[model samples]
Target: MTTSPTTTTLDAVLAGLMRRYSERVPDVQKVLDVMLDAGVIQSPDEIENDHIAFRTMGVPNLGLGSFEKIFLHLGYERRDEYNFVEKKLSAYWYSPPRPDLPRIFASELRVNELSADAQRIIHRYTDTVTSDPVDSLDLDDANAVDQFLHQPLWKTPTLADYQTLLNESEYAAWVIYNRYYLNHFTISVHNLKPGYNTIDEFVAFLQARGLRLNSAGGIIKVSPDGDLRQASTVAQMIDAEFADGAIFRIAGSYVEFAERRVLSPFQDLPADQITRQHRREGFETSNADKIFESTFTTQTGK
Candidate 1:
């Protein structure tokens, strides 16, 4: 199967877009203003209720369950969340691999000034260019077992290492359960209370306490149109049984289950065959509920 084209060429193009758009679209501060105008999400609600967090998948190192804990803390029922890195990100939300979860977990983003055309570009790129599995473990419940094996976290990352990953792996994660877009990076605004207009408001709130968040430094990207933005981060493949940093990138929490490290192969699959394999392996495309429910037993709660 085809490995992801070197991350440099693809990621560089996306990074340039991030820098250009950050200026056009407001950051956290501007997001607050827009939220007030649209009557969508509110300031207090963002901090207290709709608190959000995220993660990203690095190629070959599919960190699928990366942000399940974060989403759980926000009161998204753990059982309701899901992940996928096997197909297109949009496809997962549009048609989930798992049929159990509700759309409420799908954070409907409001691309404020984001042109419809720009949005299409973003989606099309991922659909056509990024729709392939880097590698996966061929074991039962592959994603689940791998997540347990590698608990990745470079928490004490030196500034040098932090900036390094940004250039190569622009990773992000979503909790949607659609097989087509499992482990895709999603920004679900629905987690917040109504009345907030834009997503920036919440972004600002997240930046307040100085928590480790997606930023311009590394593993993040902005779109070319100066309207939409995307960020990526790596999942530390940690396991007491495994060596420190013996990690592989993940798609959401799904680890590519294999006896050893390898890239996911579902990428080179024929379009029709991909679907057939999905069905043959009883490939679950959605798991929105399980992720949401994982939050309850998490330590992120106040």
Candidate 2:
């Protein structure tokens, strides 16, 4: 089968994301190493990426409105929308053009709903973006998009501003510094060999290997229908530099493990005959809510 230009570009874009994300999040390698050592997989390429997530600040010329365009232009179709009332967040999951590509979960903080002080601090940085930075990019040029994704959209935030945001919304503090950096890339456990193929089993493996697991609502977050279950590592702490040259340890990215069970209707189908569509799809708001805290101090501070 011939690969379309769009598919090729999407491959490069996803590859670039995973590359930098792995470097930033040590848990990614920690998980892979344990899996390899246990003979769960011989190579990293064998693991199926369920999806990757991004966090943004909902402000003019940025946030989901601006960030989603990169993947949308690459052929991703926007799916369901989720609202996190308590956290003041709105999100949408996009289905990839090709089944081989991991789905995208992009979320943004409802800046307007935040406290006045938090909004002022967020706008101070985001307001500099007079227009959507993504609008200026040639989405077809994989390299350009890769660089844009990693580039800073606003000025370096001061420690004072970061702390203010952190006190109000950890998510805001994260995006202010991380920008478009991939939040977490999920490993699909259902496809792995037995004993390491379920969220429970996979999470156990992670725990036994001495990797920290986010215990927000629970170690495993399951959907209402009990088909989509997920777990993630607490965000890694990195020594971040502030605008005034102040250094502080802040949360970075992490890795997530997911198990999308085969839908009831397709459970009887032969294992070899099953495909992506046969499994439960999309994300669950409840599960994602707790997953979001994977970066919160509640989880990281533990």
Candidate 3:
């Protein structure tokens, strides 16, 4: 199919996201290459991304508000809110202007909910971002969006501070080291061919190919309605250098697969009545809560 101008722009934006992410997590590129080699996808265009997620520290002049402006300018609208009290996170998903574009899942670490020491450590770096970085970007420009995705909003932290944040909240540590990084990109399993149309089947495919799956909350987390099934690969660890000049292996980004069921009204209806009704929209908090562990040391390992 010929790509539209809008689609072309969106592809460029997504490509930029992948480029920034792949630089830190080479496993993502490997996964995409393997998918192509195995004939799972004819090309990158055939792989429909269900959504892309980002992690940020919860603080003034930062967090979702600052990060979302770029997408918002591109006509994406906020759709749902999710709170993970246990993880001290507050997230929201954004719907794209067009159906062809992927959804956005951005989460922020609730800094105030952490210990004083941890909060201090987090602030030490976030404070360096004197102003909202997104404000300085030309949101309407695709190239600007790409630059903003890779722009570091804060100074690098010392190994000690990173360890302190890690001890308290792994999410905080991840943001501290990997600022504005794409946390994960989810594949719309239903869009794939029959052999890989379900989360269970896709998870098996990844495992058979030697990709480690996050076993927390099981390999697949299902929604209460059983309509949404999700799973993610345990993040790949990579060497990271701290401000103090020390290098350590840290958890990086991962790939996620999702299979959404049809809506109840469309399930028993005739084919005519069910036109455009096969996919379940929005996200599940329980499923996302576990998916967030993709970048944690416990899930990714040392």
Encode model 1's per-residue lDDT on 1-302: one tens digit a residue: 34233222223322332233333222333444555555545452342211122233222122233333322222234433334332222111222222222111232222222345433432432333232232232222324323432332322222233223322222211221111122222333323453322335444444453332333222123223222322322221211111234333222221111001012455565434433223211112233222221221121121
Model 1 residue 77 CA deviation in Å = 26
Give the clashing residue pairs of candidate 3, or none: none
- Please say which candidate is ahead in TM-score: 2 or 3: 2
- The superposed Cα distance between candidate 2 and the true structure at residue 265, in angstroms, equals 0.9
User: How do all models score by TM-score?
Assistant: 0.24, 0.99, 0.92
lDDT tens digits, residue span 4-111, model 3: 655566678888997777676777777788788888998877877888999988898999888888777767899989999999999999998777778899999999
Cα lDDT tens digits for candidate 2, 1-302: 69899889999999999999999888888889999999999999999899999998889999899999999999999999999999999999999988888999999999999988888888988888998888889999999999998999899999999999999899899999899899999999999998889888888888988999999999999999999999999999999999999999999999999999999989899988988999999999999999999999999999
Which parts of model 2 have CA positions greater than 4 angstroms off? Answer: none
Instruction: Enumerate residue pairs that collide in model 2.
Output: none
Output the TM-score of candidate 2: 0.99
Weakest ten-residue segment in model 1 by summed lDDT? 254-263
Runs with alpha carbons beyond 4 Å of true place in candidate 3: 1-11, 268-277
